[model samples]
Target: MVRRVMVDEEGVEMRVRINDMKEMVKEAVGNSGSSQESLEGLVKFILSR
Candidate 1:
């Protein structure tokens, strides 16, 4: 896998994959993201205990 990516000078597929992953990470951490909501829920539950 590493050798294949290194040989591809253009890095087209890798670039696209990296970009998509970045977008997904951004969305997961956004204000109204699922990850944010889960964290908030966990905090509330802990406080209620």
Candidate 2:
């Protein structure tokens, strides 16, 4: 997951972006990342059986 979703933005804008962190984390856990990809693969393996 990205550490900073935005850089050099207004506080309001940054705060607004911060609100999406939950969704971002969900996506990351959904295998939208390398680390999560490995975990997801494991989950798939189990589900495949």
Candidate 3:
């Protein structure tokens, strides 16, 4: 539940979770990352069509 997850009241847990997500996103978009590869593949496919 939302109440259970945010029990700290100061939102420390929420901030930590957000920061973790941000790090993951940065990695996913970094050089040779899966997301970057996937985007390149999609662009190639669209261009070929």
Among the numbered candidates, top TM-score falls to 1
lDDT of 3 by residue, 1-49 (tens): 6665577655777778889999999989998888999999999999999
Best by lDDT: 1
Worst lDDT run of 10 residues, candidate 2, spans: 1-10
TM, every model: 0.76, 0.35, 0.65
When summed lDDT is taken over every stretch of 10 residues in candidate 1, the lowest stretch is 3-12
lDDT of 1 at 40: 98
Model 2: residues with Cα > 4 Å off, grouped in runs: 1-9, 30-37, 42-49
Candidate 2 residue-pair clash tally? 0
Whichever of 2 and 3 has more TM-score, that candidate is 3
Clashing pairs in 1: none
Q: Quote model 3's TM-score.
A: 0.65
All models: lDDT?
A: 0.87, 0.72, 0.86
Residues 1-49 of candidate 2 have per-residue lDDT tens digits of 1334444346557777777986787777775676698888899999999
Clashing pairs in 3: none
